[model samples]
Target: MTLLESIKEPQDLRTLSPPEVGELAAEIRTFLVRAVTRTGGHLGPNLGVVELTIALHRVFDSPVDHILWDTGHQSYVHKLLTGRQDFSGLRGKGGLSGYPSRAESAHDVIENSHASTVLGWADGLAKADEVLGRRRHLVAVIGDGALTGGMAWEALNNIAAAGNRPLIIVVNDNERSYAPTIGGLAEHLATLRTTDGYERFLTWGKGVLQQTPVIGQPLYGSLHGAKKGFKDTFAPQGMFEDLGLKYLGPVDGHDTAAVESALHRAKRFHGPVLVHCITEKGRGCLPALADDADRFHTVGRMNPLTCEPLVVPAAASWTSVFGDEMAEIGAERPDVVAITAAMLQPVGLTRFAEEFPDRIWDVGIAEQHAAVSAAGLATGGLHPVVAVYATFLNRAFDQVLMDVALHGCGVTFVLDRAGVTGVDGPSHNGVWDMSVLQVVPGLRIAAPRDADRLREELREAVDVDDAPTVIRFPKEPVGEPIPAVGTIGGMDVLHRAPDPDVLLVAVGALAPLCLQTADLLAGAGIRCTVVDPRWVKPLDEQLPVLAAQHGLVAVVEDNSRAGGVGWAVGQALRDAGVDVPLRSFGVPERFLAHAGRGDVLAEIGLTPVEIAGRVSAVLERRAAAGERIRPKENGA
Candidate 1:
């Protein structure tokens, strides 16, 4: 059998000879390249961690000894080692998730795809183990770049305050995160970059001291201690040491023996120990290494024959629309600026960066910092658009609420991937933005139904000066437009029957699906009226008024069913005492696993056929209760 086929678990790896283990690393790398290339998933991050993964699995007993991968993107190699070699369906509809999934394996301790969160998890797990009197070791493998996040420091502080637990905080210093890690940590690491190499030179300097005479032994010992002190004084990581955790390494991460050796030493230490292992980001992949930015962070599906990446659609994505319009907005108004939390290209701010280099800022995975800084910019009488991924924005909720909204700063928060995002898995899904952002005081939230509205709303968001405003959109390109049949307040009536039995209120991208449902219901002689509420939050004042005229009002949204636009509309009708019965159609209030966007939507009963059937059933129930169908206020 092949090397990969011979292994079914981590125990199988421990049995292999060192040479065989090295060969197995090679095999794993090859498998990852081919598998991820075919699936269009994270490739470079996994390629860089093959040997590190081998060392981790070999040294620690996982499932018993917890292994937490901070960002989870680099855990692809971990998945391969943990007996999950089924890449045939990786990141597809029912395939293996791109990130770690607890449902997939017990070895994965946390489903963390967000950056700078592993350290905090390690601290908590280690503490819990202590409280439960469990002997299992808690190990958190965090990227060096992730240290730039403020949350990591908070975790580090707590870890230090808790003193030594059998927690191994491995800093996988890959020298990069998307774009060469920014801020103070990067500079400190740069100092160690030369200092580590100079250790060999320190050995040469030891020779010089040895030649100094009979007193050289004691003198050399004292001088060696002095040299270490000197290094620490100049490049002091006293921040970690002061917290009471043992600091180890600056070791070569590519050397499996060195990594394994350091881990073994850390296991013996009584307190929390940080083992800093330096490795390359795209170690085995030449093409990825040569790429100047992000090292091909995440890839997309491509044409098999032409070898061309498949475009989402011809019309620009909501992200690109925001990017293109923001560029013009920035040019037109000198006060306008753009910000992203280490997601410059993914959020489509690359062109914005290029056009307005002075106005754009990449905050290095610190979403909290990005949000507060945008608030500061707003306070200074400048317009700051904080464009971040829908999921990552969760990290900065407090900052958005307190610093931006509570303070009443006019910061424009643009969320890309505001609904279900496929392939990247549950941790990366943008489903909770609307639900989470609802509590922010004086925040105006808008959802664009198509590309044109995305452009216009983004412009309006930047221009709005009363309070903080958020404009969110999905991952895919804006498809076909749903032209309004009529306009009332912020809601646009897309399809209205002269005598309406049901009202279909579509929020954002769900308008097209609403139109399809209307067509289906028309065939069934249900006479449905569909409206797109462009602005979801201050909920189109006319929605309750419109709901009062119908027997049944069905609200369709792509967000969580609880606390979504649909729920808001229902509450509005309740407050107004409209008495018209309503039904809400949206994603369920549960974590969704990795699946295609359409597949996920259908499963949640958000599809056109499902919505139509559901609406018809509700209308039938209302009719059974003796409610009569009503005519439109403005006759359709």
Candidate 2:
């Protein structure tokens, strides 16, 4: 068996000699490229942390001693070190998750994919350890890109204050989060960040002291204490030291011996210590290193040799549709600008940024700052479009509501990946945007069914110069445009039977599924009509009137059923005094597991067959109840 295969647990790493550790690191990188390329995952980040992970396992005892990986993508290497060698089904149904999972192993403390959260988790775990009088060590591995977030600093502040806590914070400074890190971490930390001086000094001291007599040990300890003056010369590690946590090194992350030495020093410290290790993303992988660093950060299934995608997307993505239109809008309207939370390329703002460099702001991974800054831009007479992932927007809900909506700032929030994104698991899914944003007064929401509607609705959202407007779309490819045979208010009527028994209200990407459900209902002797309500919030006045025309109403959405657009439609019908029986079809209130989009949707019973059957059952129940149906019976 190979060196990597021999490492079934963290303890197995201690068995490797110095040369064997180097061999194992190479084997792990080679295995990652082949396995991850076939399955598709965070390739670049994992490649960068090979030696760092091997060193971490050898230094710390995980599960007993808590070790947390920030932004969970970094945990893949940690996963490999801890007995999960199967990469055949990574991020697929009944397979391993892309991020860390509590269910997957005892070592995975933080499961959420959201960046900059590991530090907070570590802080809480450390506090618990101190309170319980346990002497377990807590190690939180955070990226430099994640440091740009406010939460990281907040946790750091708390961690720094606890000088008695035994914690090791390993900052894997690959100098990236998604893209090259923005803001001012490297400038102030210039001297210490890129050098091996500290590590070299430690190595020299250890070698000489162990070879010498009893006096050599005292001499080394005195030299170590006095070495603080040398580090203070240029504030090399002054940034972390000023925070009260003991700072260790800017060690070469690729050098297993150097990283292990630094980690060993940190492990010995009684108080909190921050070990800064410098590494490169996509290290040792030529194809991955040559590719755009961000693209390689998270890849779909692709050829490992040429770094080419295995299956080319037939249609444009929802993000690209928004990006293309934004470029045009930027050219037409000089007042139009954009903002993204460290996701310029992923959110499709690359074209907009290139075209209007002066008009866009690449705010570092701080979603709250992005929202508030957009509000400030709107207040200054510029129509700012805050583009971010749907799940990330949850961080800026307060700012969107208070700073934008309440203040009547014409800020448009373009939420990409706005529905069930199944592969990355529960934390990565963008299924809660519509539900949470529903409560914001004066805010309007639009869920486009196709690229045409996305373009149309994007323009509409930007034109709203009073209240905040949100236009959300899914991560899936933009499929063929479903043309409207008729228009009722701002809604698109896709299908209509001669005498409709049920009015199927489709929200956003679920439009096609609603049409299929209508067809299934028609075959079952139940005539159905399907409509895509372009603007789900402050819904069209004609919606209640149209609902009154049908015997039953069912709203379908890709979001949670409790408070999604479905719930909004139900409230609208109630306000209009239309007493039609209604059933809302959507994702039930629960965290979906890692799987394909189709599998998760089917699991939640959001398919056409399941929806049609439920509607038929509801109709039969209503018929059985006859005129004896009790008043105020909520079909939902």
Candidate 3:
């Protein structure tokens, strides 16, 4: 059997010889490339860490010595070695997650599929171990790119202050972050890789000292003892050392045995040690390595015939629509510039970046910085449209509230993936955008139900130079437009019947489901009207008047039930004293696992049948209270 097949756990790795372990690293890389190609996952990052992962597993007794992956995207090989080798249905509705999942393995401590924040977790875990008097090692494998985030620095500061805390930090320098990582850290890593001073010193000193007579062994031991200082002088490993942590290597991360030896030595150190391992992103894959862009960071299912991503018959997503419209608007308006938080392609800003290369900025994986920076850009008299994933925007809440909203910056925040990102898990769900943004005083929020409205409203958002505007949409593509819809104060009435008994207030992508529910209610002897409220915030003045016309109103949204649009609508009706009974329906406050968007929606009672049932119950109660009711006869 192959060495990979033999490794069921970390203990299995301890059994293999150095050369055998090297062979196993190659085998693991082969398996990862094949499996990820088929599964269409974070290929480049995982491929880059194959040897580093193998060496880590070989050196540490995991579960005892907890090894946390900073951004869990690079844990595929770690997963494979930990007995989840089967790639069947990987990243499917019920399969393995694209990132490290705590449900999948005990080895995975953090569930962040997103970038950065691992250093903080390592610091916290290490402190806990010390406080509890536990002897287990805490090792965090972080990327050089992750160092860009402010949170990572905060954690590094604490880890440094602890001074001799049993923490081993592995800086996996892959030379890329979605795009070759920006800023000072990337440059420093590049310098470390090119110099190769540490490696040369080790080799030259070993040869020279051994040839010397009498006290040569003693002299070499003394030299090796002060290796940290030597490395500090020759190579400016001063970054880690200045932070009060030991620094080792710009080691060849591709060599499993070399990495294993380095890891074993670092494990013996009491203080925090950063072992810099240099490896290529998309190491084994030629196509990904050569690509100038994201290098297949995430991909969809491939066409069997063409080997390209499988294309389907669907309307353009709200993100792409916004990008296209933004580029067009930007060309006309010189003041309009675009910014992304290391998610240009993911948020469909690639076209914008390509068209206006100088006008667009990609601030690496730092959401808070992105928001604050956009505020500065706005203050400088530029209309900056900050495009970020809805979930990721939560990271910049402080900046959004304090810098942008408080200052009334004219920056437009385009929140792509605003609701129900299916497979990326709870961390990625944009469900909280409506709930979270409600707290921002001057922030104007708009949700688009279809592609055309997304384009139009995005332009409108950019034109509004008075206050900041946030345009949000789901992960799925925009469905067919409701041609009969009418708009007023950001709300769109999709269908309205004269003398309607129930008013179906729909938000964003829930418009289609509400339409279906309206149809089902009509067949069951009820004439229902459906309205797509495009702007969920600043509850339209027409909404309370519309509620007065109906005896029952059911608000359907794809956000959390707690502070979602549905709740806001009900509250607005209550404040207006419309006297109409209101029922709000939306996703409950909980973390849902990997599932298809439709299945997840259904599970949360956002289906047509469930919505219709809710509307019927509200009407029944209203009738019992002597309120006027619509005809019980069939309306269809």
Candidate 4:
């Protein structure tokens, strides 16, 4: 067996020789490229951290040391070292999670996949350790990309204030999060990366000043007193040092010995220490290294040799449709600008960026900054469209409510993965946007059912000169257009029965499922009229009237059942004095595991067959009660 196969636990790495450790690194990279190509996960991030992870495992005792990973996508190598190397069914139902899971192992902590949260976790853990008088070391492995977040800085400030606290913060500077990291932090890191000569000169100067005559000792003390200014004049390593933390190397992250040495030194230090390790995002695997876009950061199943996707391409996704339309919109409106939270291409702003370079801004992995900045942009007489994944929008809820909605700024939020993003697991699924954004007063949310509506609603959202507007769509392909046969107060009447018994309210991409359920109901002699509420938030004024004519009103959506469109519709009916019994069909209010979207939806009873069966049961019960059916009303 090879060095990798021989190792089952992190302790086993301690037995390996220098040459064997190097061999293990090679074997791990080769295994990652093959296994990840088949399983489809965070390949580039893991590949980048092979040597760094190996060094961490070799240097620290893990469970005892409390090593935490920020944005746990880079923890695959950590997983492998901790004896969870089985790659089959990765990110599938009942399989290994894509991110760190506390349930998976004792070694795993902080399962949250959101970026820039590890520092806070480390601070808390370190504080607890100190309070309890535990000798365990607290090591937080963070990325340079994650440092852009305000939370990371907040944690850093707290960590710095506790001067006697033992905390080792290893900054894995790979220079990218989803895309290349942006903002002032990236530029600051870039300066740190290039100032090696200055660092060397400063070290020599410090030693020389300390070794000189009586005047030299006093001069050295004076320089140490004003170290921040001295470093600023010479090396500028004062960023972390000024924060009352010990600063270590710009160590080559790929060199195992160098990284291990730096980590060892930090561990020995009895106070807060920052170890800056420079590494490439896609260090190994030529194809990943060659990838200009995102460095193959995250990928689907692909050929290991060619790095080309093995699966067949589906129809254009909702993101591409929005992207194309945004580019067109940008060409027409000079004041139309775009903002992204470090995801330019993924959210479909690449074309828009290319067309209007100066108009587009990448705010790093800081969603809070992105939302607040969009508010500023809107205030500056520009209609700012912030494009980001639906799940990530949860991070900026306060900013969205206070900065955008409160000010009534015309900031359009385009949420790409709006519902049930299955493979990436619980933290990634975009099922909470509708439920969470419901309480934001004056905020209009549009759930586009198809590509055409996505294009149309996007234009409509931007046209709103006051109040925040959100246009959200799912992760799946934008399938065949489901054209509306009629319109009633901005609602699309997809399928209308002459004498309707049930009013099927379809929210966004759930239109197809709603239509299928309607057909099943029709087959069972239950006449159903299906309507797609394009704008789910601020329910159409005519919805209660339309539902009042039907015997039952069933609302179906892909978001959480609690506080979703169904709940909102039910409230509308109750307020309007419509006594129609309502049933809601949606995802359960629980964390959904990793699986295909269809499988998860089916499991949660969001499928047509399940919905149809429930509706049929409800109708049967109503008939048994001998309730009189209401006649259909024509006017909206």
Best model per lDDT? 4
Candidate 4's TM-score reads 0.96
Residues 279-374, candidate 4, lDDT per residue (tens digit)? 888777888888878888999999999999998667998888999999999999999999998889999999999989999999888899999999
Candidate 1 regions exceeding 4 Å error are 233-239, 302-314, 631-636
TM-score for each predicted model, relative to the true structure: 0.95, 0.94, 0.93, 0.96
**Residue clash pairs of candidate 4:** none
Residue 391 local lDDT, model 4: 95
**RMSD of candidates 1 onward, in order:** 2.3, 4.0, 3.2, 2.5
Q: Number of clashing pairs, model 3? A: 0
**1-636 in candidate 2: lDDT tens per residue?**
898888889999998899999999999888998999899989999999999999998998888988888888877889999999999999999999999999999988778689888889988998988889998878999988898889999999999998989889998887777887887764544556645566576679878986789888888877778776757764468668889999877778999999999999998889989988888999988876777647389999989777789989999999999999999999999999999988899999999999999999977889999989998998899999999999999998898888888899999999998889999999988989989999999999999999999999999999998999999999999999999999998789999887677899999889999999988988989888899989999899999988988888899999988899889988999999988878998888999999999999999999999999999898888878774232232231
Model 1 lowest lDDT segment of ten: 302-311
* Backbone clashes, each candidate: 2, 0, 0, 0
lDDT tens digits by residue: candidate 1, 1-636: 778778888888888988898888888877876677677888777778888888999999988889999889999888888889899998878778888888899998788888888888888878888889888878898987798899898998888887857788998887778777777788887767666645566687789888888888788788787864755765465556767877777888888888899999999988899888888876777667777677767766644333256655677678888888888887899999989877788788888899889999888879999999998999998999998888888888999989998888989999998889877878778888888888777899989998888888888898887689999899887887667878877778889886787888888987888888989999999887788888888887788888877778888887888888778888899999888878889879898878888888878888888888877787677668876655445353
Of the two candidates 1 and 4, the one with more favorable lDDT, higher being better, is: 4
Positional deviation of 11 in candidate 1, in angstroms?
2.2
* Residue 602 in model 1: lDDT: 78
Error of 2 at 230 (Å): 5.3
Instruction: List, residue by residue over 366-464, the lDDT tens digit for candidate 3.
Output: 999989999999999999999998988999899999999999899899988888877777888888988999988978888887888788778888887
